[model samples]
Target chain A: MPHDDHDHPHALLPPEPALRVKALETILTRKGLIDPAALDEIIDTYQNKIGPQNGARVVAKAWADPEFKDSLLNDATSVVAELGYYGRQGEHMVVVENTPGQHNMVVCTLCSCYPWPLLGIPPGWYKSDAYRARAVREPRKVLAEFGVTLPAETSVRVWDSTAEVRYLVLPMQPKGSEGFSEEELAALVTRDSMIGTGLPKVPS
Target chain B: MTRVHDMGGRFGDGPVNPESEDAPVFAEDWHARALAVTLAAGSLGQWNIDISRHARERLSPKDYTRFSYYEKWISALADLLVQSGVLTEEDLRGEADGGEHALANRALKAEAVAGVLASGGPADRPSNVPVEFEIGQEVVTARPAANRLVDGGHTRLPIYAAGARGRILMVHGTHVLPDSSAHRLGEAPEPLYAVAFPASELWANPEHPQDEVVLDLWQSYLEPE
Candidate 1:
């Protein structure tokens, strides 16, 4: 009841979907189909523990160390498992690199099949109708909406995850970041950058 | 079987409104709860991932386009539970089952949740069968008659890519075939390839002629061009 004390509008009535979810949870829990504690753990695991930060570390290491990058580009599943970022939607891994002449973006047109272990749950836009329908057909236009503009000569490669293997775009390291530490580079890796919707932030 | 979920190159959909990079993983509390419950139910091993996906895809076109993402998930989860005999409509309405149903090896406990998730389901399987296609081979996707295949059960073959010619980019090892797997037929591990289809092949006037759409397709979905 105390959680209802909010200043914002729509605070009084829980949305329709919310009530439906609550009812379903109650029914399942009552029927011994699911555990309440396990539910808490699942939420906590994705909500806090597993997220884009794990992927940022992977991207940062790839940029900081060429050897690791080679291994990552070659055998992403084995190398990322070494870093303890493996499981679920990321059972099979493929790291696509972005060069000056080429860019790689990822989408699952059939469904929202994302690399949950590496990048956590996909953003709302990644799962929306527009993204699923348009990303494969007109990736450049979709990228522009995400504030990314590639040159005319820079060919865009849109990866539609129609199968098990998941894709992570390794954005090209920004110029002037030659001497930056891995930690600094990780900070520059945004979730969208890895998803190929936007570029990694340049060192400030 | 070519439902709304197979929408790839259909036109007139609006802009992709991506959220800020730091948006919360779950926009609302119920969304998190819904996802967690669906996943927890999934731990029972009553159905495979492909089966669960097919459940969602099985949504009628009207309901498929109408419901939100989690809404579809929870709705499908309910259907799965009923179909699996894990729950009943009477129980869903809060009526007592009188402890009649026997459920064992079903509880995905709090302690095991982390380990279960970390040791996630792996779809890859060793295959004695020879791979049919190789990288750089010219291939064309299956042009399903009447937009359905595999007895119209469940398929990962999107409609747009069907009949489009492409060159194999990379060959992923044998992986679970969703078409048969979704129907509880068998894993039927098959060689999967990341085929690179030029935008021109899949669309009328693609925004960029040089652009390519690379899709990871199973062997059955493709044939020699």
Candidate 2:
């Protein structure tokens, strides 16, 4: 709850100095103050030590056993712990099931709220003003833009997340993953699949 | 119950800007210092507390938004120091000149990232003043009244969901309040609703009329359903 959202005393908010802001950030980078390579390190550290990779592990375990999967969907925190992604934010996560009849999309209309520990760095569009404003009005259209066109008959339910519950999509397992190891199956589970867009097609 | 970073379980569908964003611009002199301040404030925020209460606040609307993600943090730190009598501008300059700035505060800088503010959009731009409401309350979504645009003020309220209805799902924190982000906007908005919008209310003649979707709506953008 920021004061700025309602404190501006005008109609449509004032446009910010976008160009100026960009120029200044460039200067900060040149000053050698920020480790130019720090971003890559951050991404790598999270991807390897934390992030969606851990989430995939959870998904893989669930795919291999129905009991475990049910535990994951019903009580994600403890089940994920059994798989060993401890202390990360998913320690208390909730898995929202996406079945054939329905689809779920996540957005933070108020701000750029996200689950970074489980998902890694959020995509650029996740923080865009356009996506935030449009996701609410035209979710299906946005999903379609991401190449996640659903059957016309299915219902699209957009979940505008506040700071309440974090969401994860349980994508259907691919056909060829039957004999794959947990690591292999984990690889097949793309971040997009968990976001409820493209399904994990059976590995050819 | 959820933190800003734990967005996965809440949103039913795709991730919101599920990726990192390009650092927005800020004035050069203010960038690093502002980042320090914001980082200190963020560290406090990790516990869901506002540090502004204990610290002297010096951030202007322009400086707040102008700062990059980290820059806001630095400025927040500096402001806190001055306010709390821990350090002064002269001390900061002396430390910088004596080469003790970074070395004396590496741990502090490391901890600066803890509770970054989730405030989106440019900090300088005017924000919407969310109308008052509670979660689960019914509301109607409508476009902004065309005539409210006046003088230099800005509104965070977007005109996208004109003539829509929803239920109050959340009451977020208050920041720079926008006087108008909706049609028939009241003077101020509080408790912005993280609402669910049916796909039908958004698009015309949806294949499934019963299917619904939810979106966050500022109190200003809605009316009683």
Candidate 3:
């Protein structure tokens, strides 16, 4: 076949180039094709970098200091402001305190809306359509995957941030951190902890 | 129709539930991308610009594509600079003289000194450094923030936050915005504690019972609260 005029570099294929490529891969898979490891590597790189890592510092501070705790419970951004950090586009932040009985999970519902300054880039899953869609609908099912089995009696508030404010989950601090310093407490505050799907418990 | 991102249920939630990221994994090949970048960089002025414009016009139609936002910014800037008289191929490609790298550090340094100047700080202040604020200390969110908070006319507090009442939650030492950079390159000003807020305070919500939100509203955005 003769070379066509469309040979210019930097020319992008029509939209959904990624989707089209995946479709091709799917066809190949149905016919017993490519190894899945190729896909795994792709997911690994972005997934790790998506969000912030604040070990339960915010929660720990809240747990320890009655005043600061009140500030955090009242307003997370202001509490963060108390520490001197601020939000990006998703400014106005809310720290949703999760009790043993009630669990709260936040999704922007608008876009994969996020609190980037506090949390950093959201994990790949946070942005995925699946998380956005189902987190709103099946909060219990999704939380279960994260090893969070909630009591049926508890109120599950799934916040859908619209324009002004964004929500961050303040996970319950670990049991042994009674004497930990603020920095130590902060270390336990992962961005995931604030997101509510994950607990502040450190992995063994 | 609202964008799938808009999420107000214009169309039904559909088969692609928001929670479904398990399968149909995305494509992310760095080698392929690096190759694509090198090749695209090789492409000339109008062609790349046209391509970029077309892509932007169509919202970068390619899916499963992996280009970091910063990567694209640099590529587009480099392309435009090379294409225009601002830079030449000879400028990018230099004869190595008494150095390991082709470009000189002095030449790079000189680029930053190229243009623009406004003020060192706001009128009457020598350095636009911030006055340290204690937690819960009362302060008014500056009327415009530009006049009160910023020593220079540069600021980061959103236009919306001007004159909002808040207290000093923390004192973030002096930091500089690009506005400060372009204007006061040497003068980094004091960063103030931004007050976060409750959404209920800003918006009315019966569904949200006393549901408060927080904002790291800059010191500029707060008045004495």
Candidate 4:
């Protein structure tokens, strides 16, 4: 939608979004405004190194160690940084615990500000207009759409990430997860669970 | 003004199609490049992240909503590059040849990419200014005096939450306010708080009356209630 060529010298620029991107990159690279190799390196970092697994490990540790959980809830930035999960879009971290009576959810009403260090890149739905608008208005209905049905008595707490701080939802440990090891618990931590859109996977 | 990017409480957009947990970090190579370029250009230190965000938000409304997330990133990158004098219009149009100008001093290198991202810049700097609000303090959001609505500039205050009453849930330490930072008007660091407003208060005829919405609001956006 940003394709208004008001001052363009060439009106015949490519129409396809991807082609336009390629053209822009080619121009930037040719003009020495960007480095292709560095671009690849950045891509690799987000593609492989950073992701939900990092947050999953944090969640797993909290589920296993009460002391770690306390540290995570009190000062998540330091605790998460201890595990090498501190970076852009995650400078300030806050972990909200979800209890039986209260469920926690997160949404960025003004643009998509997510915890890239821990959760890697946010899901598409997290950036969708529908989720951004309706998450705060009808969180229950939104959660239900994600197949997360909670008890009527439970109150939902939706966190609108409006500032520099980023939030990670610490879902209630599922029943029967007591005997599971930390590694196993991490396996059950789904991306949606940490975002508060869905519950953590139960033993199945 | 309430930009298209500030989408809170408005509805009827469409259904949400969530990808699987293991979905790829980027849908295409261009997306990766877009992100990389944005980050690399940002490392030049000419502008901050908040400025970059404002660049994206300042796009035309049709462009703001029409551009896929990464497309927005690339568009913003181009805008920033041109505005910062790093690239000319001819350069973006692909009409200019290489060697026209010297590159920015802080251009990211391949070897330093991992190190740069791993040792990411944190925005939470301590402030000497005294905090204005405290946890559990009841406060009302500051509203535009005449119209009863907040508008204009790059503000973190969402339209829906403006002029609402809420209780401070937590007093997050002083940090850079995006509104001022986005305009290169200094950090303007202030005490930010996680304010909790009842869902019923934010919306009329709320579906979940007992539910609460917590928003991280800056001190400047609130008045003691």
Candidate 5:
């Protein structure tokens, strides 16, 4: 039941952000404005239930099944919804496939508008000013920084998510991943790969 | 009009320092609380997501960048609470008496959190409005005059893409325009498009001229070229 008493005249604590948040929660709880349990529930949902793994699963499915890939590419909203990953920022989904000749990347230059239902909260770098400005201007260089060096002939198509629609990059399937199971393939798909900042883990 | 949030192609920002893959979802407890409070406040349904975005963008240019991501959320939440008569400065400062107040009618419960998160609020709504443009059509983005750098209010059109010529890759069905929806002006649904601007057009001396940048643009932002 401890709360940061900001009113203390000579308080020792220097008003840390965590303490301030707790103070706000305490006030709201007292005022019957917010439920502490509900707050914990929301925190748990984002922390556990939703995340990059969801997007990775979609990628793995698309990689394993061509029909699913076509459906995802043609109607991402319906396909992604069928998998129970449609919500909020991801109402209208667009799946951009990454081929050998074309590499796709996504960024919300105006603000960090990411597919929360698919990828959870965006990574710090995705929301950072540097990536927002540079991704659209110099995607190839940015890709290289993420250890995603493309061939000279390959084209990097950047999608600046400027509106309500969200994008998911369908990274190229790595060679030798042919016999892998869906779960195994999902494990190989990293969040950055789906964001077009990195590549899928190659089979050893 | 060239709002601080529309930072597409401008340079001299900084470095792109990405976090490692194992980074925790919420860096701190406060980060979680900030999100929870924002969502809880938003559940009241007084304002839509667009309005909430505007609240964040309305922060001073210095303050907008100065605050961390969730810190921006907290500031916007507080701003909306006061603006919507949900709370006052005294309530936020803990100066007001903590009298029992009526809880919001639509307070989200802990049990409903998972359900709500799973079934997100889809923005795609059927509109009888006929489409004005078609796929494969060449179009030019409406360029705001130099003196009027913005569309007068909250807009999804990035200044960098302004005046650029592009081809319509797809004609997305009628969707609510954020510019109007955010301000509560009206639904003002319009046909959105996936406009593909060649790299050469968006940037001079492009590294890969064959590459293109696609943006989800509204019909009002474009004109047949």
Candidate 6:
């Protein structure tokens, strides 16, 4: 027999931000300007339907297929759309490849513009003042903080999301994974790796 | 002339703190609500995305820095709702009765969410003017007179990139000009390009000498160097 856990209680203890959201929702719903059901759909779409997994799958396919990789690097928007992933902030897609000589990183210094359909909502750190301010000036130093210390010889290329175009970094495939299947490679693709903040997991 | 939101190359922002690998998309339930509501209201067609971005940038410097990411979104959404005549402040404060709905028909429905998200609003508009610059051409971003801002309105050109010289990397097709579209003036499509600035050119003392920063700038923002 097991006892019920009491860590999370079913109470309406909303925080300040939560309270503000509740009030806003109430007014909007009353005015018939927004539908709560529709709001739920949007939340569910981002929370469950969309995420970095989509980008990881795209990366794995590129890694396993040479033609796909070429097409992705050349025409990223159409290539990703072929995978049934295209919309929202990811309408204009640009896939930047990371190599030993040139390391690619993406940042929206003016705002937090991310590829929502491919990478989902922008992460908290990506929207932070510190990352937005320092990434352009001291990318190598920022990478070091993220535990991604590149060689001093390798030049770091930072792409600012200044306009509608969104970027995704296709990280380098690890050594000794030549025989890995697409599914196996996808499993090794981490979210941060696609964001240029961290690398993919090494095959076990 | 520099807005508080343009935070590139600014100093004293402290160290970067990345969240854990397995962090959830929404840190709190309210964040999800905030994002969803904002997006839903935006689908009402009252204002464009650029207008919404301008609203966020319009926040005061103190409030902008103090508020959390979602806090900014929620706060801007409130102001936009009132400004667009979708709802009034009295309604928000529960001090007045809910009036007849004029924009109710435009409310996004749950069933249409997937399709709406899949078919995003594209900004690429055909341009009649010839592209003034080409790939590999050296160009410099427009710089207003000292202490003057660009139109004192919504602009994608950050302060750090202003007056900086860079080479054109790619010739992106004409897209809707945000500076005009934000003010509901017109799309005013123009040539967009990916400009690459060397670290030495963008900064006085470069941290990574070999590195470069790339930005997608409009034709109007660039001039022959």
Q: What lDDT tens digits, residue by residue, belong to model 2 across residues B36-56?
A: 333333332221112331111
Per-model i-RMS: 7.4, 10.8, 14.9, 3.1, 6.0, 9.3
User: For candidate 5, lDDT tens digit of each residue in B47-163?
Assistant: 888778877776667757787887777766666666666776678777889986665556677787777666666666777767888889999998861212224467888888889
C-alpha root-mean-square deviation, candidate 6: 7.7
RMSD (CA, angstroms), candidate 3: 13.7
TM, every model: 0.94, 0.55, 0.44, 0.94, 0.92, 0.94
With a 3 Å backbone cut-off (N, CA, C), the pairs that clash in candidate 5 are A87-B120, B1-B150
In model 4, what is chain B's TM-score? Answer: 0.92
In candidate 2, position A61 carries an lDDT of 76
Off by over 4 Å in 4: A1-13, B145-151
Q: How far is candidate 5 from the true structure (C-alpha RMSD, Å)?
A: 5.0
Task: Give the DockQ (2 decimals) of all models.
Answer: 0.41, 0.16, 0.08, 0.59, 0.44, 0.39
When sorted by DockQ, best at the front, the candidate numbers are 4, 5, 1, 6, 2, 3
User: Model 1 chain B, TM?
Assistant: 0.94
- Residue B51 of model 6, lDDT score: 84
Clashing pairs in 1: none
- Give candidate 4's error at residue A165 in angstroms: 0.5
Question: Model-by-model lDDT, in order?
Answer: 0.84, 0.48, 0.43, 0.82, 0.81, 0.86
Q: What is the TM-score of chain B alone in each candidate?
A: 0.94, 0.36, 0.41, 0.92, 0.92, 0.95
Docking class of 5: acceptable
- Candidate 5 matches the true fold with a TM-score of 0.92
Instruction: List runs of model 6 lying over 4 Å from the truth.
Output: A1-15, B145-150
* Clash totals for all candidate models: 0, 104, 46, 2, 2, 0
Best by DockQ: 4
Candidate 3 chain A: 10-residue stretch with minimal lDDT: A1-10
Model 3 TM: 0.44
The DockQ for candidate 1, computed on C-alphas, is: 0.41
